[model samples]
Target: MKSRGLLSVLTFSEKRENLLFLLLNEPKTIAEIKGYLNVSTPEIFPRIKEMETKNLIYKENKYYALTPIGKVVAKFFQPLVNTLHVIEENEEFWKEHNIEAIPQCFLERIDELGNCRFIENRLEEMYEPHTEFFENISKSELVMGVAPVFNPAYPAFFLQLALHKVHVSLILTKNVFEKVKNEYRDDLQRFLECNNTSLYVLDDISLAFVVTDIFLSLSLFYKNGIFDAQRDLISFDESALKWGEELFNYYKEHSKEIKSL
Candidate 1:
């Protein structure tokens, strides 16, 4: 098979793809592979033989391992698979929302959010605080957020967290900043006075997200430019948390810090 044919060898069969990823972690004998994959010998043997012919895997004593070429393929293939899974898992959310709010660099690493799950608010619950989001952040030692739109309850809620000694950081859009400064002036002042809190303001953005020591909560605007208050992507994975933090820093670098107001 030509090198181009190798792509089919890896993707055409789910069993073959699973076997490749199973072996990526460590070499495994045919019996171990069969048990781990829950496939019988008749089903798995042909895959091993085909992979052997493709020079993607080789047998040594009782073990089957990836060849040098196979390792290179797996290194790049895994990320693509993970990225697809992340988007496909929430196809409507990705399609309906303003994904352009995410910077290109971070969009390239969308696989990092593969472990996330959606938290949807019912229409009747739209005005209520996300109980899970608030509870999780309240327990976090550090919290960071980007707010493109204002939520009336957030000023006091986040201020309470800052007062409780949680290290809080926020990037607000110009309009949101003005709302906080004008309506929640006292809370904004005290939040800024806290040694543990920092605030920055930037021009309008099209998304909102909160990343904390324990979790990440991301929300986006609809294609019609309305903020989707009902759906959020939340993740507790370490990689997702790191991805969210880098996203916060990206906007933070572009925002101006508001020390007093």
Candidate 2:
């Protein structure tokens, strides 16, 4: 019956049960607990009061610690918890996936084993480097962008910028828009509407480019689909940004000039 009740408590939990287990490690005063949990007295006292009411803990020298009941519960939970950790050992699924933003607090307490291998593999994947291109993008405070190919790699930089809330403006060419406009319009629109994003579309665009506050990038398209990495690419520093910005402004200001063709 006692073990069944313990299992019941574990099953009933909608969130972290680690705190209950941690409490059994030592007798601690209410103030000490509030401090360690980084929670306020008001938020914690009620739960402590409830645990005491259930006789799960008792006070000694004004320090409330887990009772024998709580200790037994914690011990019974250990094996079930450890069995839930087999997923951490898998290394394959993570290679093709990204889970960079999951926080530590969420990761530590997970005890389920079924998806453990996939998750472990997913967590081990590393960032792929684009060398100079990534370096320039990372250093920029302002990035003016256009993406013709919708590279999955491109979204990675945007996610990084999102963490810092950096400002970015994107002007995509007509050809790129038409190709993706029907299929990915909603997702692309939301990304453009997200915080710090400003987007524009330019029709009849003959070229593709991205300019950072300090650098400029240019790429050309081919009719035969023979686009190679070395073909028509250029990178320049501050001087290029200034020139590119001026060219962008001229094109933006004279939208009517290129509207027909």
Candidate 3:
């Protein structure tokens, strides 16, 4: 059989792949590697040997470390693995939703939403604010959101957050803004008057999401163009929060700030 290439060397075995990842941060002695991976010397040594032969790793002074090339590969490889896991973990969600609303830049970094979980409302709770989302934002120091759809309760609820001195920033679609201005004028005015609050209006958007200091909550329209009110993707990971903030900022930059009405 022809010798397998570097791709196979890197990907063919889970042990080898994990060993490379373990070495990414720093070199490790065999004892450290064995303990970290919970594997015996006999099982791990052969994988390490194979990687060493491929020049993906090197040993010196009783420690194993990735070579320069290995470092580069791992740097790129980790993100690929993370991205795949993120999509595969929520394959039905990704397939059924309208992700085209997400900007290309943010879509590329989707892996930053590490270990996100779905929040699916029960049948009786359909169209209600997600309880977990509400509870998290209530305790957060800062809250930012994009609202492409309007809920009757949101105007008063978000206004209450602003009044409590939570830093609140929101980008609303023009239609939603109009609804708030016409029917919730009092709440809207008070929200705009708060020193810690800001509001902006943009053209129609296809998704709604919120990013707070503690979490991110994302809702998308279905492929059939109806908003999916029953499910949301939520994450408490720091990287996910940062990613969500960037996404909010991207929309904020293009929106027109509303000072009154």
In the predicted model 1, the residue pairs found to clash are none
The model with the greater TM-score, 1 or 2, is 1
The digit string of per-residue lDDT tens for model 1 on 143-230 reads 9999988889999998999989999999999999998899999999999999999999999788999999999999999989999999
C-alpha local distance difference test of each model: 0.91, 0.54, 0.92
lDDT per residue for candidate 3 within 38-75, as digits (tens), equals 99999999999988988889999999999998898899
- The TM-score, computed over Cα atoms with residue i paired to residue i, of candidate 3 is 0.96
Per-residue lDDT tens digits for candidate 2, residues 116-218, read 2211112223233245666777888887765445444555466457456777766666666555556665556555656776656666454445677766655
Error of 2 at 50 (Å): 98
Task: State every prediction's TM-score relative to the real structure.
Answer: 0.96, 0.40, 0.96
Worst 10 contiguous positions by lDDT, candidate 1: 126-135
Clashes of each: 0, 4, 0
What does the lDDT read for residue 177 in candidate 3?
A: 94
Clashing residue pairs for model 3: none
Alpha-carbon runs more than 4 Å astray in model 1? none
CA shift at 197, candidate 2, in angstroms?
1.6
**Clashing residue pairs in candidate 2 (N, C-alpha, C atoms within 3 angstroms):** 87-116, 87-117, 94-121, 94-122
